[model samples]
Target: MHQEKFSKSTRTNKQVALHTDVVVVGGGLAGVCAAIASARSGAKVVLVQDRPVLGGNASSEVRLWALGATSHMGNNNRWSREGGLIDEIMLENLRANKEGNPLIFDAILLDKVVAETNITMLLNTAAYSVTKESANRIESVNAFCSQNSTYYSIFAPIFTDCSGDGIVAFNAGAAFRIGSEDKYEFNELLAPEKANSDLLGHSLFFYSKDAGTPVEYKAPAFAYSQDEIDAIPRSKNIGAKDSGCKFWWLEFGGILDTVHDTEEIKWELWKIVYGIWDYIKNSGKYEDVENLTLEWVGTVPGKRESRRFEGEYMITQHDIVEQKRFDDAISYGGWAIDLHPAEGVYSEKPACSQYHSKGVYQIPYRCFLSRDIENLYLGGRIISATHMAFGSTRVMITCAHGGQAIGEAAAMCAKLNVKPKALLAPKLMSELQNRLNGLGHGLAGIPLTKSDVLLKAEIQASSTLALAEFSQQDDWLSLAQSAAQLLPFTAGLAPTFTVQLSAQEATTLTCQLRVSIKPENYTPDLICKTIELDLHAGEQTVSLDFSEVELITQYGFVIFLANDKVQVRTSAQRVTGTMSVFNKVHKAVSNNGKQIAPPNSGVEEFEFWTPERRPMGQNIAMQITPALQSFAVSNLTNGHLRPWLGSNAWVADLSDKAPTLTLSWPEKQTLAGLRLYFDTDSDHALETVLMVHPEKRIPFCVSRYSIKLEDGTVLMTEGDNYQTLNTIYFKQTISTDKLIIELSHPAENVPASVFDIEVF
Candidate 1:
């Protein structure tokens, strides 16, 4: 085992190296993001991390799932988020591991940190000291690695301490505090009955598997009940060997001593962890399953409480419980004030409560910077906050947002050659807030240079700018990944966000985000989505998928279940398919034509149509032609449907007796055209339906021409035919909303079992 320890060093005074504008200590999520922000803003940066990987708790070290305000339902279907480096991480994961339990989270974090050219990362390094010429300026930062015991210096104008532990801040001569201040500090309702229980806890999480066969295991000699176990009431039933997760075994983080007792707590944690398994197998809980054992043991203990330094804005519990919003709020969090009760130390039930506000609450940027220290900035759990406020804001994922905010601020300071506190000023604070608002997709653009006045600009080649602005009191993490990108580009927050494009370059382009719960949308390759954006033409606020990412990895999903969020790299040999369900009907395509009912095979499924908002009739028409079955195209949002909502993968059923159709193909086959027939069964509200060919197998039903039924007129071909080979088109030309398609044209020999169709 590689024991991570600092070696003996006698040298206190050492020469420091100078480079870059900003130096971020602690390469966790916040540090990584801050580095990216600084580097992207055209400032050089050197990122130092004690550990080898990035992402802090979200990294592989702890392996806790990414938890923010997520709209996820077990990793299925489609979703979106605000884009940035986090979006990039998510997109990479989608490209590598599509299904849930995204395993490559560590690699994804590392890749982003390494990909940027302006940022230099120093791994396996620790920040030992921060030398300052004055409180207003950081002269140098010294880092040491145990591997070499040599101190390396990094000098920068601004320094951000994203080291959740607040080690750097303390070294920088910044006054810091640990534990709770007063019960009224944050005005939290669930604070300690009287005084605050300044205790913060951590857990040793592990993954367990069920053993099919019974196995006996002996406990260690010291594995006996003590005051620790006696105090807290154990369910005695929480541990189940068959269960895949086993955090219930967490028995650390009580009063003996927070830091000094770490090793002892680790020892006690081990006993309870293995003891539960011992009872499971010996106690007969393992009798039902097959082979079972520990799959993974927690490496870095999940620390819930730690040191916190006073920041420019000391976020109070009242700010959270009362839903206090700030005009300069850069990020939002509203997960609820969940207080885990410590039952062992005080001999009382552990405190656990769920508190909700009328709406989301915004976290101000001031909470990220040091108020006393001139050049110091704090991120993650150690940011300036009262005990109760930290209780709500200290979550890893939410803290990551704090990390991102500070990182960006650090970048902004470096680029502007200003201090982080400068950002707290009204003009700068509002600008940063506007930038965040744009990134959140809540508000658009920096509120600089009013839109209406831009139309009368004296400059030549000026387009009529109708920019209007609206701001939402964003307090939900659901939109955390939303609007952080606009400033560096749209507004002058980062200033370098301005791009000088060639005249030939299309103004319209797809903007991919970096991190998201759903990774399918983000891509290293610039996704060539049609551009219709009228920037500088209109000033309007709209919610969009600009920062949302989608991806798929080919080898990750062994057998993809419907609605599973997936990502895949396009391969020439790859085969794909789609399926949809409607009111009382299911539709798909096949080699010959659209199927009346989809084949009852793994390749396809059938669903009967039901009444809906658009329209419905006795049946609906489905079309499959030679034109479909083989094609390479960017992923589309609407091309298929399923019995359940957001099912990315779907099975199709083609049945003429009912409003259902299906299509099938061996591989990529050349198809001429495709024809879809509709009955509007009983509705006309349906306007358009898009088609996607997952299999890339062309449909052979329609020859080289198309047929249009517009105005009840049959035509040899409907509209324009493009370079589409395997896939073809089907639009509602009948001026009606719904349709019933079938493969009754037996002469075409089309089986109607194609699986690529989506109606949105």
Candidate 2:
């Protein structure tokens, strides 16, 4: 090998020139996703992050929990988890760290980016300068890494601005709006009467730990007084165990510029945090906080709103509320229009104003590409949307989905050697949608029709379909002293309930069925039915048939395992429409020598857990029949829109035996692969605010299935699937005119639904 000269003749330190197919600025969830998506699609990518960590607000520095479609759970739009790369990250986190630890999640995100060979990550590098070849095309971006005191000039054919602040777009001279839009501009009721510079503001959160003993506290110089705390409307919401984020109302600098005044905003937030903590501990009002101490406080305030770049289409509040369908839709969002007052903590009103959508809304590809810059794309919170619309789409999961779309689009642009605007062509847009759908990305109303042999065939199913799972099983569950499983029940009468349990040793146990007076909080307050039993060491079934128990509200079944040796059986299969609740127990015993049970004393004391809630992956086992319905088999190839909770997919009637679906074509067609999209409760967002769901796969997913060609020719038999999308490629090409699919319910007497089926 020949070696060159050590130094250049002209300069001491020169800029490092790095070339890539695509350059992504910022390493937040959006940037990470963009880089990953691009790399996966055969593009050389360079991901530049200003911070050392990958997650932006979700990282340890900011400590904001990831939110997305789950934000609209109680607002009629349920089970709307952002699919694709975001889902992959969530599922990986659920498998590794179900506790939702930010540090562990940070590592998970970092590992995901680093694992991609085509992605070159430059942490601690900030992109500040943009080089454009023409008026509309960005040629390169210059970033400085202060850690090594090195300047990097990264050249790329395509660029994605996933930076939450839209730094790349701003520097590239892309047209963008800094604040709210006028109501008349977008015809949005939520928008201000006239355009304003007010923003959603920034926030910093802190966590507290129990010190086991009384801890003395001193107020800082800028600490807020008890009188000042009393001025706020929701001051009573704070508690000893409450985190700083819970007081999201503690925001500031909305009236000021969120970017230029960031430092000022951060300083003010710190003062507020210390003041809030001081009032809670030293005010002598909250005696329960005597043992708690501040464990960690965020230095960098997590930003909510900033520069929103202009694109071919600007999403408005009407699009979200009406749930508009777009022909070029690439991703979807379902979070309610959660708009907060500009006067954060100072405001006397509630923290936010929420407007829910009829259901999840589709985000079009037109919103991802910059209107003026041909080579530039926008993602994350900076996508093209009015302030009111951004309230829903700005969520991290939605941003992550947007990032994935732009990444895929960037890869396509680089491959085709065309500008992003070129992809807007009908044929190209369809190709992009098909590719995204094939990869399990969100495109609500758009069906996968490109080269889909199943789309051209006639379909028939064996029986009428069921919308939801109708089976119930008694499985094993470990019960804490203050734990209660919440299930949806009719309010009028107490029906016969059957529960099976097994004890390690002979023990006495009490089972109480209580009515949740506060359905919102899911508290087991009023006792409707109770049963006392002496459980044996082995398995035993207890049936309680109560007559005329006046149930006024939703029901919660609480099991009191007085003896630590007893364990109740819970359904191993996940029930999508129900939820469970566990009370926050500081100690096993109460002030008296009695074991603590749920609905202990206060209204906000219990931690409610819903079905598909993360961390607790499995649902509580109970004896009840789920409502069922019949669905068409043709819906299997009708695209990936779950309009109602269980409406879009092809639902089969409740059957213990396997049901068959047949696809017949007029003539033999060459087939190389097959793709199946199952109904795994796509609407049920499977991650939790504090805990991750234990299992990503639902009971309705086709765990066991077989496929055969015409004349009884075996194609694939006895296959298992656990993901939302399952793709199978045959080793050898198979030519067939007809295909038969046999599916079995994973649970007893349950129904299975096929969201989409494709033959390539």
Best by TM-score: 2
- Tell me the TM-score of model 2: 0.74
What is the clash count for each candidate, in the order shown? Answer: 127, 18
Model 1 earns a TM-score of: 0.56
Candidate 1 Cα errors over 4 Å, as ranges: 1-18, 71-83, 98-103, 135-137, 210-232, 235-237, 241-251, 254-260, 343-351, 437-760
lDDT of 1 at 271: 65
User: Where is the poorest 10-residue window by lDDT in model 2?
Assistant: 586-595
Residue 113 miss distance in model 2 (angstroms): 1.9
524 Cα displacement, candidate 2 (Å): 28
Q: List model 1 lDDT by residue over 402-480, tens digit each.
A: 6666666777777787877788789887766544332221211122222222222221110111111111222111111
Candidate 1 overall lDDT versus native: 0.45
Please, what are the lDDT tens digits per residue for candidate 2 over residues 259-302?
88999989888887887788888877776887898888888899
